[model samples]
Structures are given as structure tokens and as C-alpha cells.
Target: MDKDTKRDLHSLPKTLAELVGKHIVAAGLLVDEDPERAYKHAAYARRKASRLPTVREASGIAAYTVGKWQEALSDLRAARRMSGRDTFLAIMADCERGLGRPERALEITNDPAAKDLDADERIELRIVAAGARRDMGDVKAALAELQVPELKERRARPYVARLFYAYADVLEELGRKEDAREYFARASSVDREGVTDADERLAAIEGVELVDSDVEDGVVWTDVEEEADEAAAEAEATASRERRDDKGRDHRRDDRRDDRRGGREDRG
Candidate 1:
């Protein structure tokens, strides 16, 4: 857990604090690999410490991860109220969209509190708002909504690639194939971490087909195949890290049990 979460739990009795902290830690650990189990952990923490805003936040995020839209929206709203922070507005708006309430999502973007968000948060809101417009079958309006100056930046920031990709996707939706291809290429170039599948989209636009090297008939090698291999390798690496983290937690639990048994022996 982070320092802020620890501080929030400080007011609880020691035993209760320890239990909630353990659940929260488990939730964080399992969230990526096993989101359903992570949601269970977060829910356990919420049950134990219902009054804690951080616990509510954790529960909300876990619910979101697991696609429990209603639960996520309720928990996130409670968290926002308790914490008096609008940091999760983007997720909240997304949850609204998840519930098929695009109009509600747009309403959230227009909220007075939205103005207080930082630059990154505002960009996130614009993205969601554009998505909401798309949900309403207004592709042109969606494209217009994403026409922020940040989208035209020459250098790539983490947000820029996603913004460009979103714009390109909207362009494609509106039958602007050439523009879509151009923007997809631009997005792919800036996407150093391969966060978006911009490369794949660009390849599809250019009618480039990729064939697996292990195919029996004919194997065609292309840059797209190399990119796919890299993506697979990265995914495997992430899974490996998650496994290591899970093992580390189990070892810690075993050590604690051993310590308790040793304490009993010492007392005897």
C-alpha cells in the first residue's frame, strides 16, 4: 500500500488495520493477473473498513476492472464524496458509458468540477467525451471534440499517442480512410512502448497481411510479424512478473506463520 493509504488506516484498531491492509495489498497484487480475485479482496477490505475513502476507491477500481459497472459507479461516487477529490472522474464517466449512458457521460464532462482537473485529467475527459459523442452516433462531433492542440504536438508524450490513435479511429469510422491511415502511422511512430495497436491498424489500412512463421503452407515474414512477436514477449514478461509477485506474497505469509509458531515455542 502507499503512504496515503497507510495514513488513512491509522485510525483503525491494530488488528482491524492489519486485516484491511493485508486485503488491500492482496487486491493490488492480484488486480492485473486476476481481477475477479482482486475485486473480492477489495470488497473484503471495503466490508472491513467501509468508512475509509481509500478502501472505497480501491473497491471502485477493482469493480471497474472486473466490468461490474453499477457497483463501480456507486463505489466511485462514494469515494469521490468521501475523499472530495475528482481524480477518478474519468473512470466515473467511463462507468457511465459502460452502463449505456453516454449522455450521462457527457454530462459528467460538463460538470463544474471538471474545470478543476489538471491538464492530463482534462485530456482524459476530452477523450471520454469524444467517445460519448461516438456512442451517440455523432462521429463528426466526436472528431471535433478531439481537436485539441495537444493532438498536433511534434514530440510524443504518453498521452499523445493515445489521442492520435483515438482521432485516427474516429476518422476511419467516418470513412476518411486515407486520413485514418496517416494518423495511425503517426500514432504508431510515437508509440514507443506499444501501448496502442496503432501499428496493426496502420498495417490493416495499408492492406499488409501478416502470416505466422510456423504455418505449414507458406511463411511470409514482415515487420508486423516482428512487432507481434515483441508484443507477445512483453505480455509473457508481464505474466512472469505477476507470478513472481504472487510467490513472494505466499512466502511472506509462510514466514509470518513460522514466526507465530516460534513465538508459541518460546513462550512454552
Candidate 2:
């Protein structure tokens, strides 16, 4: 429950406010772990508090997380109208792209407020707009769209790694392997939170096989190989547990059958 959400619920009756707040909190908590469940919770909250812009915003985000592109776009549009804020224009454009409407995505980017977005939101808009360009098979235009001054910055902001990663990915798509590799390394250097898989991209570019190791100096050391091995081990353990449970059930059945036979013999 953020301050904005609290303010939205301020006008509601106490009982309705509590219920909507619980649902919104549940949706927020589950959005990362189980997005489908998160969407359900957000939907419930929206149903209860349909007039609240914050509720619509939460539902829109939850819908996006679950890939319900049309629903997300609709909810986000409603949120924008109610709140008179265009903060989610990037997400709206992304939802249009998700629905396979690259032209519509481009159209959304033309909105006047799109230029007024904060730096991070502007970067996200550029990324999505670039993606839409790529979707339209104009890879050159896509490459051009991502060329911004922020890409040249050596200082690490949360969005910088992502920008570098996007640039690297596009370069790879254009068969500029050397340039792509350089940008990937740059992205990896600045990615303190492991937000992008820049390290994995770098490994692929250099043909470096990765293994499981402890994180050193903020670098994530895990690899797909280790993840595969863990998945296999878990599957084997599950099968073993099932086999033991089956065997135990069989043993109990045998004991019951023997006890019945002994009773019959005693009766005879």
C-alpha cells in the first residue's frame, strides 16, 4: 500500500477500504512470484474499487505481467484518464507491441507527453519503440532509435545497463559481433543488480563455458548448466520419493491381506 494507493482509498467506507487494501497488498506481493495470481488479486481489487485510479493502475500492471496485453492496455488507458497522468504511456505502447500492433505502438510514442516522461521512463519508451521498429523489420531504424546520450555515460544508473544491453542485442541482430561484444561487456560492468543477463551474453560471445560459483564483487556466477543440473536432480528426487511411497503402500496392503488370511485360518 503506497501513499498514492492510500489516498485513493481514503474516500471509501472503512469496510470496503480494508477489503480493497488487502487485495491490493496481496496483488503487489504476488506480482513477482506468481503473476497470474497477482492478476486475480488485482482484478478483485479493481472490481471492488473500480473508480480508483490506483486500482486501475495496479490491475493494468498485473495484466501486463501476465501478458494480457489488451486488458493491460484498457486498464492503463482508464488509469491515465482517471489520474490525468501519462506515466504509463511506455507500458501502454509495450502492450500494443505485445498485441502485435507495432504501428499502434509507434502511434502511442507520438503523444506529446511522451517527451515529458522522466529519464528512466523515456529510456523504457525508447527501448519499446526500438522493439516496435524491429518488429516492423526496420532494424536500421531500430538501431538508430537507441542512440542516445545516456548510452555514452560511464556512471551506472539502474537504466544504463538495460540501455547498453538493448544496444548490444540490436548490434548482434545486425551481425556486428565485435561492437555487440563490447557493449555487452560494458553492460556487464555496470549491472550491479544482475537486472540484465549481460554476463551470460558476454559468455556466449566469448565462448566461455559457465559454471556454478559464488558471486564475486557483484557479478552473478550462476549458469544455465548449473540450473539444468539442479532441475535434473530435483526431478530424480521427486521420482524416488514417489517410488518409496508406492512401495510402502504395497507393503501395507500385503500386511492387511496376511492378517485377513490368518483370521480365516483361525475361524477354520
Candidate 3:
């Protein structure tokens, strides 16, 4: 367990802590192989110890794996509120995307502490940010959002397979089939563990299902957004300012373009 998680669990009574700890361990172990079971374990842990931030975090991740968008979002938000450390910003943004509210996903990525994400987290955030653009029906802008220097690196970095896969997916959407094929090939080469269906995509055997999340801005608004922001605000109070997420979403030009289409805020 991570130090913060250990510390959080330490405050619980011994018997409850042991029970929660067992479920947490099981969830982590099965999350990759049997996410449904993992979610059950994590959910049980959360039910037993809803006040524990770590348990909530685990539950949120487990639910996210199973595509329970609203449940994941709510638990993650609770985790952030209880811990005052918002490490799941990217996940929360993805949950917004899963919930078909990509604009809100983009807005979540604009939190001041966004720049404090570590490398892998930054990449995840960038992916979600690009996905939000795609969801808004701006394929060109979506491509621009993923214009990070790491895209060119030869050395393997974490999440590089997913990065290549996302880029290829966008290229396919824009009718650049050749470019998409190239990226899918690259993704397949790196994805030894088959995290994505890049192999099937490269073989042209996978069904091409295009999901559209195009909605006019200002047409969709949730009353609960304010509460989420307030929770994030409280989280920012405890986030260490010393850390920095080296990558910034390199999409200023995208924002300029989006401004003409719709008023969307830009962040570094």
C-alpha cells in the first residue's frame, strides 16, 4: 500500500482496518484479471469504510474499470473531499467522458493542480483532454491536443501504447486511414500485454463503431458541477505545490479555433 493509504487506514479501528485491508488487497490483485470481482471487493470495502479516502479511491477505480461512470465519479469525488488530495483528476475527467459530458471533462482538466500530475498521470489527462475534443466533434482540434513531445520518443514510457492507440483512433476518425494504420501498427508493436485492441484494429477485423458525443456547448449543464468544484477546491488546499506535471496540454491553437466555434477556456 502507498504511504498515504497506510496512514489513512491507520486511523481506523484494528478489526475494521483488517477487513478493509483484505478487500483492498484483493481488489488490487484482481483488478487487471477480473475487474468485476475486483469491483465487488472494493465496493465491499467502501461500504464497510466509506469515510476512508483510500477505500473510496479503490472503489472508484474498481467501478471505473467496470464502466460504472456515475458511481465512479461520485466515489472519486468523495475520496478527494475526504483526503484533500485529488490524485484522481484524470480518472474523474474520464468518468465525465464516460458519462457523455466531455465538456465537463475538459473543464475538470483545467484545475490549477493539473500541472502537478506526474508523467503517467499527465499522459492520462492529455488523452482524456484529447478525447473531450473528439467528443465535441472537432477531430482536428483533438489531434492538436495530443501534440506532445513524447509522441515522438523511441524509448518506451508508460502508457505509450495507449497514446499511440488514441492518436491512431483520431487519425482514423479524420479519414487518414494510412496514418491510422501506421499508428495502430506502432501501438501493436509496443502493446505486448494487449491492453488495447490495436492488434485487431491493425488486422481490420475489429468492428469500427463510431460513437458520437457531439453536443452544443451551453446546452448541457448539471446542477451538481458546483459541488464537484467545491470538493476539488478543498482538495487543492492540501495538494503540494512543489510537484509539477512537466507536460502541459499543447493546444493553445485549439483554444483559439474553439473560441470562434464556442467559448471554451484554455489552460497551460
Candidate 4:
């Protein structure tokens, strides 16, 4: 490639600041499962929209997954400032907790600005706050943070799982082994199909199994049905072989009887 081609590629329209919002969204979606790749994409998006809050948020998420805690704190805080009261605040609290400053994390979540977080985001914040309190040796306060009203409702299984999982940690910390095991079991029940490390924690507590749900986005039902049908056909083919073996045993029995009858007739 020549210098002119490189310059043109670098100057592409999609690389421009004005058109980076959608790419930022895409970068966020990729961060959890593919952080390294997501980080590269987020970097490109940030180059185009460094001032955009979502761009910075995506960068922070990717960096956090890669264990770049300081970078995550900086980018997430910047995103929180630029976005002016976005979900990035809760995310930044998580970064604080990750860096072993749970008290600061709790303070961040309690900010009046964070009070209006949605159900899922609120639950997430509480989980982090609970951990921070636990780290601070406040076991009761940690459990209290996870005891929100929504946790008792079946419709809030995901949130409830998060609560139980966090509660289990506090229980374990306080040397309440049996209670911790029960809480861990409860967490496992609700966290099925989860991709997070909470599942592993639940398993360690006892009598819990992690069953991953395979729900792929953008995959067609028709394709799934075709795959199922193919599997069924293979199963049927195996059954057919078993039936043929049974038939071979019956044929051998019939041949043996005929030979015995013929020999008896010849003796007579």
C-alpha cells in the first residue's frame, strides 16, 4: 500500500467524529464477550468521537474486562462527566470496587445522581456496593444492600440471583458456611444461562450446577429446526442398526431349530 492510500483509508467518512455514535454502541455490545477485539474497535470509535460519552464508556468497559483498572477508572469517569449523569456512573463505581476501594464505590452509588438508575442498573450498583461494604468488614451492611424489594419477586430472577450471589459472599466472609451454601444454591437456580463469574461462585458453595443457555442473537429459528432434525435423523439411524442386530439373532435361532428337526428326522 502507498502513503496516499493509507492517508485516504485513515480519512474515511466512518472514521470521522460525526458518524461514530452507532459504532460506539457496537463496541459496547462486543466488550463483555470479546474484550480485546472490542477494545480495538472502541479505540477506533474513540478516535472519531473522543468527546462522545458513549465512546468513552465503551472504552472503559473494554479496558475493565482486560484488567486495565486505572485506565478504566479514568475513561469511565470522563464518560460520566461528559454524559452528565449517564449509566457510566454506576459502571465507574464498579471500577472503584475492582481497584479495592469499595468505600469509594459505595459513595459513588449513593450519590443522588445514581438514585435514579433503572432496575437492572440499580441491582448492579447494589451488588458492587455490597461487595465494597463486605470488604470494609461491614457484613450486615453488605447483606442489607442486596436485600432490595425486587429480590423477592420471581419476575426479578436475574436481579435476585445477583443478590443471593453477593449475599453468599458476605455469609462466607462471616464464617456462616451453611447459610452461605443455601444462598449459593439460590443464586445458582436463578443464574442459569449466565456468562458471568457468579455462576462459578455459586457452584463452589455446594449442591449447585451451572447450565448454560445457548441463545444466540440474530440466528434464525429455521436454522435451529434444521439442526434439530439432523440430530434426530442420526439418532434414528443408530436405532435402526440395533433393530438389524435383533433380526440377525432371530434368524440364527430359526436356522438352529430347522437343523435340529432335520437331524431328528434323518435319525428316525
Candidate 5:
């Protein structure tokens, strides 16, 4: 847990705090790989301490990962009300979009609390806002919404790559193919950590298709373990063949020796 979350759990009895912390840790560890299980862990923590903002925030994230949009919105609302933090502004808006309420998402993006968010959060909100506009079929408005000074940022922050990607997508929607490709290239250049699909998008614009070689021809990808097992099977088969050959040669030699011994006895 971070210091801020530890501070949030300070009000609980030590034993209760430890239990909640364990569940939170488990939820975090599983959220990306096993979202349903992660949500269950967060739900367990929430049942124990529903009033804590930290628990509610964790539950919100887990719920979001599992596409439980309404539940995610409820948890995030409770967390914000409890802590008065605007940290989840972008995610709350996204949950609104996920719930098929793009207008509500736009409303969240326009919320007065948006001003208090850090640079990264603010940019994420803009991205969600653009998505909401696109969802509402106002593609031009979506394009306009992404036209911010931060779009020109030279610094390679996570949000900068995302912003460039969002802008490129909007430009593509507006039929500005060249402009879209340019921004996609910019996004790919700054996305050193593969946080976005900007590289693939740029490749697509250049008439290139990016494919995973292992997934070609509808074949399932195999791991190193399967390859190793195949190698071991081949080695065992070679050894077994050698053993059979040696046994066959030894039996033939023994028969020849027996035949020679019979001939000598007959001659005597």
C-alpha cells in the first residue's frame, strides 16, 4: 500500500486493517490477469470496510476491469464522496460511457472538479470526453474537444502518447488521412512502453498488416514448455531405436557362433 492508502486505513483496528490490506493486495495483483477474481477480492474488502474511500476506490477499479460499469460508477461515486478526491474523474466518465450514457460521460468531463486534476488526469479526461462526443455521433465535436495545448507537448509522458493516439483517431474519423498518419507516427515515437497501439495504427495507415507469427493459419501459439517436451520425446525415440538395433546385432552374432559350434562337433 502507498502512504496515502495506509493513512486512509489508519482509522481501522490493526487486525481489521491487516485483513483489508491483504484483500486489497490480492485484488491489485490479480486485476490484470484475472479480473473476476480480483473483483471478488475487492468486494470482500468492501464488505469489511465499505465506508473507507481506499476500499471503495479499489472496488471501483476492480469492477471497472470486469466491465461492471454500474457497480464501478457506484463505487467510484462513494469513494469520491468519502474522500473529496477527483483522482477518478476520467474513469467515472468512462464508466458512464460503458453504461451507454455518453451524455453523462460528457457531463463528467465538464465537471468543475476537472480543474483540480493533475496534468495526466486532465489529459485522460479529455480523451474520455472526445470518446463521449464520438459516441454521441458528433465526430466534429470530438475532433474539437481534443484540440488542446497539451496535444503539442514535447515531453514523452504516458498521457502525451495517449493524447496523440486520441488525436490521430479523431483525425482519421474526419477523413484527414495524412494528418492522422502524422499524429499516429508521433504517438508511436513517444510510446516507448507499448501503452498504446499507435505503432500498429501507423503501420496500418502505411498499408502494412502487423501479425503475430505464432498466430498465423488459425494455429494456437505454443510455449517453450511444449517445445521442450517435443524435443525430449524425439531424444527418447532415438535412444530406443539405438537400443533395438544393438540387441538385434547381438542376437545375430550369437546365432552365428552357435552354428559354427554345431559344425565343429559334426566334423569331430
Candidate 6:
């Protein structure tokens, strides 16, 4: 390997712990995309500095993303033990959700300890908590938690998307088809250029054929529907065999009656 090619990447920090912390922060941002990779980076960071709250929090988030619920909980516990701060409470709540303990997440969001958080932090906490509440079939509670005027008036696209999606999901679950459709459409329109997933969904909701799937009977059939073709072929073969057997039985009955008639005629 060329020494020049092995040059320092990302401007190595003066301190080894700082370099690890920076890597952990970078890995935390990748939880939604490359969870496994994020977990590896987070684990590396924690190995370098186990007492760092930020590293443990990043590990918790990455573990949650990769479906390691117990590991996530352990990381978050270590983070809280080290700092006693709520820097990553939202992600911790997400861990609880992944672990099938959404109610516990909700309880943490509602805890009095969250009252001292800043405006932005408060909103994030509420959103995370509401997600848990929504998962537990408490639509009203989730909506109530987010109905504050401050949050409603905010113009953050990501937050708006979260609110819209949560509201739409609740309405849809409650059989309020029109309301849910309207909210979903609103969410879809927040980004109209199709540069994001929300925009694509908006195009879909507005009757635009963006993906070429024709929906029928509340189900969509796509280009890769070979599984259905196999099942249909098997059904048709079974039906064909049944019909052939029925026809053979009818022919045999007709021949037996003809033989009986011939016997009677000979006797006469």
C-alpha cells in the first residue's frame, strides 16, 4: 500500500477518545440506512471509550436499528448511568419500542424529568413518546400529546412528516378513511419534487402511476408476480384432473347401462 494512499482520513483528532467520539456521531446518523455498519462503528467507539455517554447512546441507537433490543437497552442503561442526562432519550424510547415495550417508552416520555428540556428537545421527546402510544393503540393519547400549538406551528419538514404520518395512521386505523386520506395527501405534498420518499407517496396518493402497480381488491399486483402465477397454475391443474375423473365416471356408467340392456334384450 502506498504511504500517501494511507494518509489520515477525516483529520485524526489529537486525542484518541475524540476521534472515536466523532466516528460514533457519524455512525449515529446512519441508523436509518446502514444499521449493521452503524452498529460496528458504534461498537468500535464504545470499545475505545466505554465511559463516554455519547458513544453508549450511539451504540444503543445502532443496536436498536439492527434489531438487537437487549443490547440497545444495555447501552442506553450505561449511557444514563454515566451521564444521567436525556441527550438520547428519544432514541432510547425507540429502543423500547423495538423491544415490544412501547408502554415503557411512553412512560419515560411523560416522566417529570423531561420537563426541563428545551423546545426542540421537548418536541422530539413528545414525538417519540407518541409513537409508543400510537403503537399501543392509544391514538387519542398520542394525538393529545402532540396537539400543542407550539409544535403544530413549527415548519420543520421532517417533524411535519412524522406528525402527518402518525395522524394518518391513527385515522386509518379508526376507519376514518377520508380524514386519513386527506392527511396522508398533505404529508405527501410537503415535498412535491419526488426527491424524497414523502414526495413519491404523494404522487401515489394523487392517482399518479409512479410505480406501475395496478391495485385490485385492496391488493396491488406488480411486475414481479411470479409467485401468484405458480399458485394459479397449480390450481388449474388440480381442477383439470377433477373434471377428467368426473367425465370418466360418466362414461363408465353409460357402458354399464348398455351392457345391462343388452343382457335383458337377449333374455327376452
Each candidate: RMSD to true structure? 24.2, 14.3, 28.2, 10.8, 11.1, 9.9
- Write down the lDDT that model 5 would get: 0.91
State TM-scores per candidate.
Answer: 0.76, 0.80, 0.71, 0.63, 0.77, 0.61
| TM-score of decoy 5 | 0.77
Against the true structure, candidate 4 reaches a TM-score of 0.63
| Best by the lDDT measure | 2
Model 6 regions more than 4 Å off = 1-15, 18-32, 154-156, 191-208, 211-268
Model 2 per-residue lDDT tens digits across residues 37-56: 99999999998998999999
Runs off by more than 4 Å, candidate 4: 1-26, 195-268
TM-score of 2: 0.80
| lDDT of residue 160 for candidate 3 | 84
User: Model 1 over residues 1-268: C-alpha lDDT tens digits?
Assistant: 8986898899899999999999999999999899999999999999999899899999999999999999999998998898898988988999999999999999988789988888778878889999999999999999998998887775766578888899999999999999999999889878776679887788788766656566773335366666788999999999999999999999999999999999999999
Worst 10 residues of 3 by lDDT: 241-250
Expressed as tens digits, the lDDT of each residue in 213-268 for candidate 5 is 65544223344455688899999999999999999999999999999999999999
Supply candidate 4's per-residue lDDT for 237. Answer: 97
Per-residue error (Å), model 2, residue 232: 29
TM-score, cand. 6: 0.61
User: Runs in model 1 with CA error above 4 Å?
Assistant: 210-268
Query: What order do candidates take by TM-score, descending?
Result: 2, 5, 1, 3, 4, 6
- Between candidates 3 and 4, which one is better according to TM-score? 3
103-155 per-residue lDDT for model 3 (tens digits): 99999987788788776677788889999998899989889877787677555
Structural RMSD, model 5: 11.1
lDDT per model vs. reference? 0.89, 0.92, 0.83, 0.72, 0.91, 0.69
Candidate 6 clashing pairs, residues 3+ apart or interchain: none
Q: Please name the candidate that would achieve the greatest TM-score relative to the true structure.
A: 2
